[model samples]
Target: MRKLFSIIGLFVSCLLAAQEEEWRVIPSVREWLEEINNWPDSVYRQDNLHVFFDYEKDTGLIATTFEETDSLPSEPLFIVNKPVRVSGLNFAGDRKGPGTMPRRLTSIQFNGWLTISRMAQNRAGFVGCVFKDDMSMWDIQSRNVLQFVDCDFEKSLHLYGPQENMGFYIANTSIKEDLIITSGNTDAGIRILNSDLSQFFVNGKFTQFRMDSTNVRYGMRLSNVTISNSFQLQNTSLPALELIGTDFPELHTYIPFHNIENALALDLPIGWDRDQDLVKYKAESKEEIMDTQRFDNLIASYYTLLEVYKSRGELTSYNACYIEMRDKVTARSKLLYNQDPSFTNFFAYQINRFTRAFSDYGTRPEKAIIVFFQVVLAFSIFYFFFPSSWNTTNNRTMMRRLSYLGSYFTSKEGLSDLFEKEAKEDYKDYEEFHQFISSSEKRLPIYFQWLSKPLYRVSVSRFNLSRRLLASGDILKGEWDQLPKAKQVRTSILIGLYLVIYLIYVLIIRCLNAITLSLNAFSTLGFGEIPTRGLARYVTIIQGFVGWFLLSIFLVSLIGQILN
Candidate 1:
């Protein structure tokens, strides 16, 4: 009789277990309340929600709402002690998603402000669920977690009164308003992924808010984010607003809050559009800018309003406040720049206008180098037309009469060779020098080619004697001083003296000696070099005077470029 009873008990237990695992249909809100209120401790797991089988059918699992007239206490709408799962949030009504089967949309609506108050190890989770109104958490107990995936909150979510060590994971969701936390959260964490929010705030605390691929309209205004142990807002376009003790500490866009005191490393367009006429530069976007004190105070309030409107999901009001604040700040910045006579502000604007393209304040060192070369080229032109004064009878009236066209193919070395003793239109020596390399490279080994590089450079550096001949021809053509015999005899004597000093100087001044001699002559830095007797002394004096003005401007511009 005992063995028969034992066998019967075992069969009944197995049947009960099968029934527990079966999906039961959820009835009215009042019925769900009665069902979970007296759940067994073994049936409900801490930090986990097993709601898949808790609901009867997969097709339509809905949460019923209470009427506004029903004056219930501040208790949560559902005091669920059973483990819940965020496994069935489906918006398409046809549950077709990863880790979810074919089920209808799980829609939950509240009369007004809905509250989810959790305590002990009991947690709440919603998946593929949509909340039709504002959602708030009254008091989240320690070690309790609230999570949502593929959920939509039609309004704001308040998480103020949660206990320490509480956590939440929200992903693939949209918070139409703010995810605000007024208080509570000691060593707690909240992770949101691929979600969108208008604003996020934590009341100047250090609860880490980690998110990736999330977009926040107005951004986060927390006091200390980096103070948290593992803070991350990776690949999100939420600009940091709290200047003190806050940072993204991961992937972020926009300059940091601490970097705002410096001029926005941004170049403004002259107007909204590019134009050929300079009139656009004179156009002001705003008519008036307030005083510094008043503007500062006004912006603080404006910033607040901007955030507040953004948190409310008021798009029109958010945009209006944002644009107004932007315009005011821009106008005030211009006012500050114009009011100061210190070249600091003026040149910062102007130089960046060229180097940075007056759009993005991205630095272009190449443009600065190009401008430097252009200025140097202008000075090179001035040197070309400068008078060979002392050579003429009336030194003051002496004009550099060398043909501009001829200067393109000339050097003083070849001119000296032609006018003195070696007077010829063709240079056989230079031709031999060129032909030697062209023929020699063919027969040489690869190793010899490497050795011949220095020789090749030396060969190429020598001016073309053929062009030099043409240039010298132009230099000597115009003259009544054609007593060729006597003049040639006198020139030979002068030529001998000139070559000795010229060759010596050329040898001493290696091509790169410009760093020493040219720079010395180009600045008022009195580290002087003695030039051989010629037009050089006069050139030096003139160069030094002109370079002082040019160099000063360049130095100012260079500083601006580096700083900006």
Candidate 2:
């Protein structure tokens, strides 16, 4: 780009050299404007304007080349109607000398705007200068381009009427305002390259609106940049607005415009942007940082950025903006109470942001996954600590024993009589068996009866073992009075069955299966086919209830997103 400019400079130098030289110098800015009003086909240099401002008597003053006073005026207002070049001047305030504090500049106050009316064959430009209020080329009566480069404006500018044939070029300038061009029923091609604009509003109709390599403070607000003709925007940034190209939606202003970023760019005092005037910002250096609203202004600008991301369908960037806003809000909220955010904002409005993060403020449905895992872990711990009563099989055995005792108590006879009758039957059976055995042994072979004794013992022992396997109570091989009863054993019914085969550490029965069980429980899908007896079954039931509630919250968040 510099090379292109250099080539253009060479051509202009050659063309001027070919023509007759009418080169001249002016004593003051008043004389310069006078020269422009008279002759429109002359060339001027930026050094002449600097030389005029260096005259200390009129250090911070201005004129329209109409007044001839060398005294204080209401404000600085200048008219450029011919070819002019100027740079580095402040028509107001006590500013430092040249390069005293570089990059810091004093401003020229335009109480309202700059007036321009140029003829053909002449163009005007101001570089590295300051204009406070606005710049308007609304009265150019000839074919000439008015360019502003490396300059600063406290407010916006405007151009209309015959702007196409003599288009304007604004490069490397900073505007602390929105640029508005009334291009309706015109063929002007407005080109703004490599500059920062707070905003842009192209009203009416136009043939072309082109902006490139520029950073727009806030995004643009326009239904369209042109009226059935041309509008183009590329390589530009709407840092605050996030509008790209010409895709500006029809915007409605709930509040008026504030070039907050430009204020920050100039490092002006807090609330300096409230008024669209060029004024040097000043405050005591010892002021508390909390009292300054530059941080708050930054947050407001970031919110504008957030809206831009939202409209652009950039969720990642949107989330970034939200995080920054959250932090900034925390900082600003602390200023409301005290400077110590850690101590003062414990229960303030800023704390709401934490709650929002935990639940994602109903914006993220996926956080339910975290809740699901949390609940599963919680219930697993509960079940681990509290053993279930239903798993004990001893209760069933105790109930059976109680029922037997009840039946015996309800008998017609007393306990002694019952025992006597059973004993007499047993004695009669023994005597009959003895007599029969004696007869049979005498009648049959003695060797056969002797050989069957071991077999009879084996059969009796096997029968006792079989009864123990099927019975819910202890097995007795002999009469109850003849032997001491074995102690009953306590055991888990269904739980013991699966555990002995499938579980070792007692948690989830199998390590890998824990995740499956947790997920199923969280989803409220209790597929009972998996033998979940005793404490495991109890935990599953509890998980079902909790899972239902968690899922309901997740669904609510999802439906909100869809509706929104």
Candidate 3:
């Protein structure tokens, strides 16, 4: 008998472990009251209520209520003790009362969290139901109860009633703030107002509610959002408003409400139809990935030229070098032009990407040297036959002209004048403009080719003659300058001297441009191929150096014979 009792106890324990709390549906208001009065102090979950009304049937404070109905239970109440999720909540029934009669309960409150997961789906095809009754301290102070009824409360309404109520209140009572209404739709929505006379702090997706000036109350305000398709109403006072993404001001848009002290990043359209205009701009400038390789070499050639100028210690040349380098960096920045919202985003993104790699594997001086040398050699070989293709004068002019055009649309005063002119020609017709930018990008090699020709002649002469000059006793600092007698006799050789220096400068520029452009196009690989292109471009850049060495050696030999 003792063994049998033990087995039975084990079975009972197992049954309790697997048991789940059940929901109770009360169809009548009297039944709801009976359940609440007899309910335990512990938590209970209620469910399956077709309608709930807030009428003064007798009790001063009733948690749930509904309008009068026939065939109701004599004295019915159902108490639930478990977490419950009601599939539907409908309050379509009507009640008779004075004009000031509260169609819904005036003060409904919850001690625990009442999370409405999907408000949009919950509020389909229902109208004229009092969303909430609030005489709670929070409700009276919020000054936004009327907003709940006037606006589309069916969308997302959190009515604050009594502070003591627990069923609907789902926030930390310890928190000195208002109750929070969190709606979990594609548009996360919220409506929060703490105490009476306090301003309503509304946020989340306004597009879900579609609340405009005609419906929204003066006390209720809205702010932060991930996205919006609604237009901003004029004469609205929302201090905390923000519009994210690229500027498309002409479309319907609304601003978020921000407090006076916390400044927000407001995006204003700098150019007309900014998003579409940017697309066209980006498309026009988009060079084929393969074409970028050639452009990279061209930039490398200019960089090589800059190095020669730097070696010569010319301040003007250095300034020109700085400007060209800036342009190269800026051009690379354009390739990844999506780092931020404003003008510098692309440039910043490109720079940051290169800098990250530059920090890695490129920290050592020897590694830097090897990387740069490789870029020069690779770029030189690519443009060796077309040296003049590295010229940058036209590219610089084109960018400058575009800047001027940007500036023309900057001011409202000039906007009218510019629009009048722009209107004469269809602004929408971008085919010519597109072609112009494309042709310029495509002709990048031609510029370097022109710049490289004179460089080739100089490189050849430096390899043959300059080396001999440096070696001979006759050659000294004076050789750095052209001889007066040579002016009469060796005009050809003087021209050679000019070519050598010019070639060195051009080669330096080309090296810089090539590596920079490559980095922009290939990102992480840009630094890796630095040595590859550097070494190739440097072959041509260094060819002139080799000529200098040979010329110096031959001159030293000739001078020794004369001295002996």
Instruction: Per model, state how many residue pairs clash.
Output: 10, 4, 117
lDDT of 1: 0.47
TM-score of each: 0.45, 0.38, 0.24
Question: What is the TM-score ranking, best to worst?
Answer: 1, 2, 3
Best by lDDT: 2
Give the C-alpha lDDT of model 2.
Answer: 0.49
Tens-digit lDDT string for candidate 2 (386-467): 4343233234544653454343334443333433343455556555755666678767787877865555556545544554
| Model 1 ranges with Cα > 4 A deviation | 1-30, 33-111, 118-123, 142-144, 223-226, 239-334, 337-370, 387-564
Over 1-564, each residue of candidate 3 has an lDDT whose tens digit, in order, gives: 999999999999888854532223344444454454456654333443344333444232222223322123333223222222332233322244322222232222232233222111112221112222121212211111222221112122243222121122111111222223322223332222221211233333333232233212112323343324433333334322222322212234333222111211122122123124211111114462125554454445444434444444443443443444444445556664643356577548555455333322112223333444555455444654333333452345446545534544343323234333534344333445445545666566777656655655564454435435433422222232334665525644553575477557756776565545433332222233333344444544454454343334444534532332
Candidate 2 Cα outliers beyond 4 Å, as residue runs: 1-113, 117-134, 139-146, 154-156, 160-168, 176-179, 185-193, 196-202, 205-368, 386-516, 529-542, 545-564
Model 3, residue 261: C-alpha shift (Å): 8.5
Query: Model 1 clash pairs?
Result: 24-55, 24-56, 25-56, 49-83, 49-84, 50-83, 50-84, 89-127, 89-128, 90-128
Worst 10-residue stretch by lDDT in candidate 3?
A: 118-127
Per-model root-mean-square deviation over C-alphas? 18.4, 19.5, 28.7
Cα RMSD, model 3: 28.7
* Residue 352 lDDT in candidate 1: 39
Q: Which 10-residue span in candidate 2 carries the lowest summed lDDT?
A: 99-108
